[model samples]
Target: MPAEPLEKGQTRFALRAPSARRVAVVIEGEAHPMNRDPDGLYSAEFGAPAGTLYRFRVTTGGGEELEVPDPASRFQPEDVHGPSEVVDTRAFGRPDAGWRGRPWHETVLYELHVGAFTPEGTYEAAAGKLDHLRDLGVTAVELMPLSDFPGGRNWGYDGVLPYAPDSSYGRPESLRAFAAAAHERGIQVFLDVVYNHFGPDGNYLSAYAPEFFTDRHETPWGAAINMDGRGSGYVREFFIRNALYWLSDYGLDGLRLDAVHAILDDSPEHFLTELARRVQEGPGAGRHVHLLLENEENEASRLLGGGSSDSVYTAQWNDDIHHALHVSATGEGASYYSDFADAPVARLGRCLAEGFAFQGDPSQHRGNARGEPSGHLSPLRFVSLLQNHDQVGNRAFGDRISESVSSEVVRAVAAVYLLAPQVPMLFMGEEWAASSPFQFFCDFDGDLARLVTEGRRREFQKFPEFSEEATRERIPDPSDEQTFLDSKLVWDERGDLENAEILDFYTDALAVRRAEIVPRLEGIPGTGAQQRLVGERGLRVQWPLADGSLLSLLANLSEKESGGFEPPPGRLIFATNDTGPDDTGNLSAWTVAWYLLENNS
Candidate 1:
């Protein structure tokens, strides 16, 4: 049931509870019984002002009474178990009316966690850093989940309350302020939202509406959300409303859906397709909205609206690029990396030439074909990243690439994604190479804490490094406060010479990319960029320009220098090595260089 807004100080509340025998709206210790309709919907009108705290007193089918917050609450001052506050978005109003968002193809995204990005760990603190991101050439900031989870610290994937911003990160107005600050600087903001499963703690939907979940499908977390069973219409409406709330109320530009593959729905119109249509052609029309998915299944059809011309998502996260790069850099192929182990460099080249490496190919890691053909899609339909939260935090030690590989190697890898045609995303500390690690962390108390720690340890047991007991002891406890503290980015380190060198490399690369590639991207060949393997461990990509010129990037992926090769017909634009153009045209180990060729050659 929707919470309808009336006059300034009034709100109309309605709830649907078929199993509830009696329901009352208890506001500030006063009880008001709501009138019920024949369809099991209870309605009540209160003289309550904004910020008034209230909850529902629900009498169960068997006469057991329970007190729970509203399923559609916009704000929870006391979190999940406490009273829900009335948040009138109509009161605060939209901050940036001139903000229509930026072009999706021109976007250079920077993903960050609000808590670990700065020492203050609040929306206000994150907003303070917008100038820094603007200077780094970041067109948008993709924040990790901010939905209200159980405790003070979390990765945000375990959020239970989809509507309320976590109390730990200030109030609802604080988030609005952050979005306003970003838009004022011409930077768009997107929120990462989880719809796969609710957090283990503070999930009250099942307590009142068991029909919200179904045993027909099982997710890695637990029972899947009901999208096609009895009572699924309201369940579907509940999530779609949450998406609209964030975009219209908080002024967010887009949403990065957590894992769409696990959202098992068998309806005539898929949930994601329906969500896209509502956001694009519904009330959100005339406002630019981007929808991105993190679907591991690599279903290219989703980006194409499942072959329907009416619906479409903006893009999908391309994990094949990350896995191939990881195998090439670390040279450690054990679990999922086994598929890319044989020809890691070639795989990386293919990913650059094409959008995905495993498109319809049999993967040894999965023992089956993993992805569908993605050749017919635009390069902008895939988002590539070098280091994301999952790639770093899921590690046994949560170590960054700066700690695992050589500095020169890291620079080459950075140039590959930043200059490629696809959309590039940078993790929080990747630009400056911050020393802190983004480890797996949570704040669960009592027995839950112990169980979470044990589960984490068991997850890493398959890795040969964590097979021994002593090795397991070294694994940081996910429940410890120290783990969260250790993950905060050290902002001061950006000024150091070692870190500044890497940061400058990224800034210059992005500048050259915008100047050369972004303009002529729309009309590129359907086969994507033209690329050829250079010798044994080298690759050269030629991006066609409108003026009949080419933007060429050459790199040596091996540890030894590859010499005696003629340079591409162009003036050198960028090189990872400190030196400029050489007499012999030799490329050092783990070096990448970009050049611009004119119409002459």
Candidate 2:
């Protein structure tokens, strides 16, 4: 919720610091001490006008004084280390006031990082491009994290102040305007948020409330957040409120929680359950407020309605489908790719027909069983994608698959996910096969910059390709401005012939999905989709409709063309390679075709 500027130009301030002996609201070098309650909350009303900058002067254990930004700051116009500005989020008018968000099953998400989305990289500039996405059949724009970070350029996962929108993206209202512009074009907007751990730089929670973090468990970042430890109820409320704030204040349609697997909690009722419950019971009760999760563990229970009635998330990112497609496109079996290479096409077939490929099955790559049975769940419960931030940015060179695979492979993969029953997502520039790379870029300074650059290079030492001296030197510096500049998308190339061809493929596939597939699949309910391997690497899928008709897909995964496979006697709708029956009817190598099998009975 936004702070209310009371009458007489005084603003009420509050801080939840259980361990603080004294707290003061400092405005322009003037300090006004606050009153502490028995419940450990310190608050005071001061004669500070709206937009007045303020910071907390807290006395912690042992009487150490520290100045820090408010944990629930509505706006941080300066750097994260600077004071917070009082923002009346309600003052901004909702541009698309009549827009009620769409349902989960209707979403066709296009993910992009605002900084590298365009040259200007501001919300206004990004909003100007919504027409392109809207024309391409994108229903929503899943922005990469926009929370306040240390510097101007970042991937946004390193955000510290979760409540404040990054000043580099313009004011908070700019983001609201961006969302409204998207809504005007009939597109929904959502944000990716990081709650597992705060970034290393600009973090100040420990100074006043060290209990916000705990050593009970370890995550890849370090000690996990105090989600279920002593005094953790307050910490949980902080994040739960953050979730509601984004939806209610910015008019955002939803939120994508990053890496829920890393959020360690052992309570009887998980924090995620609590978050869902509170959101549905609070301001989001009557809205189409969707919650998406990025759970790397492939956990399906939470998504399969194991949580409370109102606590289940709409869906989760299906990395299994992406891994299978990546392995099939390029036979790179390093790291996490190893588990997906054995029978890549078969694995993809499973994901296309079912929700997960590894459901409580042993993972040869992880040396243990992974995932849970999700076949009983709806196919829309998964968000399938070809290229995303992690898949591209995690590479040693931060190269997209477009840089790695042939144009034919890109078209085939695009057709697979776009036409599948699951909700489809396209990374920015993926539609036109943009040439620019989306690298791991940042703007950290001094020792932290050096450490980040060195650590990024060192982290890849496990791979033989990155360990070599020559390859190591080729790695882009994460802290370099040039690296950040290199990641910007080139909007002019959308019309180039080669790029246009791929873009046409995406557009045509999406058009077909909207006009033909979605209505039939969503209107009627069954097992969603049924699939059978046509050959060693070919798959034939049948999606039954309400009228007993079937929408079929035939795909060839091998490089060599094979013959003698026929559709169930219906209209031939679309084809990638334009290959038909080889006198006996076969699909060409790396080709995908869709057919509408009408009910003849």
Candidate 3:
């Protein structure tokens, strides 16, 4: 194969596929022949190129001309999803790229949707808010997927262009600028990416590149991507290069892979295993690269590769705990609420102390046994959170769990999540209890909008509380400035009474975790040992603190019961839930009491 070049007058391009004999690059007014380079890279340069009206002319194994985007183009047209405008990824002023790489457990993650993170809702607006996260003790911010979606606004799961930051979010410059600014604040940035399925609309890859997917395999959305098919070699290369591009070209600190369980492959060791290896050898790994997954299978294999990852993806989102806690927090008896209700705090504590609950337990929802005992993995390997974006937006009205629980319970739960052995993550506005709802929002063409509105209502019709009419009505119009406005964090309310109190509680809780617990967790001891003294209304957990003491921190989960707690008679550091008339946001429900026991012996 030979590298492709612009035929006389052309402003567009296509990727080199060794299997394809002929290829053409089509810009606005002209089409050019492409030559493949020795490295299998397709090349076509234009005299003048600027906007998004670009598509490829690809000739596959069989003689045919179909249009597709430059496999890794930076920006694509809104509706066409064909070849996109070529961008100099380094065009947006590149940062010094030097960053202090922090380990997975060492990071405090703050998750935000770029579209709704600020009133401007672009990458630039988010850059302005880095100060708030820095002050809140956040060392990293994990962004929702930024790949190019169909319309001007989306949740970003239906991305078609993997190489580019969504043009709707801003230009390539804006994204690179934001990355540079974030690094300057001593904050690492992680990007979430989707590869399971190409979206329904604006997916034109099938037109030009037939080998990218396989009808032999099935996915919930459509045909599974051709990972293990005849041309699987290039297929793996396509995704692996994208992973490294974000880390090397974009200077990303980490990647949160969306729906890895859906990415099925029969290759030896697995694509995930290979992908993790390549990323660790990439640029971020020179600094360091953290890999995370949103998995439904609870498969331990992704983290078990023993690859060069900092801690083999230090943690996964603990959804079973989230489900259990959500059911306990909100009395809402809705879908998938079966396994949780009435599940004791002991069960929750066991999951926190160790990862993976439902280990061989008969799950009524799954109709089978679930999970192996995660006894051997470090506690820092599972990230636990009270509320994330999915828990909110996926709801009919997108009600936050805070709406149901008392402030005390919220504060207490926050303590368990932030102070626990695993990494802690926070959804936007959760720290201050913002009233604005983060509803399911999207913008599609008019007829497609009607289809989406109608389709969404019919899907959730079974839930008694989920009204079809209201569900349809609740889908926020993505283009509406008001919808975006409703989601921004209200920074002004930080000094108000209620929000201020929530802020103080969060700050104090964070202080305790860093000061009292982190060191002990860094060098954990024992393998597969359960330590707990259960009482009628309280529980005491005894685990060796890597710092010094054989620590036993007891908690009273029930207000109706009390017990005697004898320490080594050191200083009482802090009491979390002791709610007084003039207490500083410390309440009876969901509270913590801290102590620094001294060895007087």
Q: Give the CA lDDT, 0 to 100, for residue 367 in model 2.
A: 94
- Report the lDDT tens digits of candidate 2 across residue range 1-601: 2345687787889888888889998988999999988877888886887789999999997799999998788888888999999887777897777887886767899999999999999999999999899989999999999889999999999999999999998998899889888988989998999999999899888877789999998999997999999989889988998998898888899899999999999998899989978877875677688889999777887784534343288889999999988988998899989988788888988988778899989988889999977776777788999999999999988888988889998888888899777889999999999999988999899999999998888888899877786687779999999999999999999889999988888898899889877766554442767888877788887777656778778888778887646755577677786654445667788888888876673
In candidate 1, what residue range of length 10 has the lowest lDDT sum?
302-311
The lDDT-based order of candidates, best leading, equals 2, 1, 3
Which has the better TM-score: candidate 2, or candidate 3? 2
lDDT, candidate 1, 305-417, per-residue tens? 34555228888889999988888888979888899999888888878776788888999999999887776666778898989999999998889999989888898888888
**lDDT for position 146 in model 3:** 84
Which has the better TM-score: candidate 1, or candidate 3? Answer: 1
- lDDT for residue 30 in candidate 3, whole number 0-100: 76
**lDDT: worst 10-residue window of model 3:** 579-588
| Model 1 deviation from the true structure expressed as Cα RMSD, one decimal place | 2.0
Score each candidate by Cα lDDT.
0.84, 0.86, 0.67
lDDT top scorer: 2
lDDT of 2 at 168: 95
User: Once superposed on the true structure, which residue ranges of model 1 sit more than 4 Å away at CA?
Assistant: 1-5, 304-311, 522-525, 545-549, 563-565, 578-585, 598-601
Q: What C-alpha lDDT, on a 0 to 100 scale, does residue 540 get in candidate 3?
A: 49
Residue 470 displacement (Å), model 2 = 3.4
lDDT of 3: 0.67
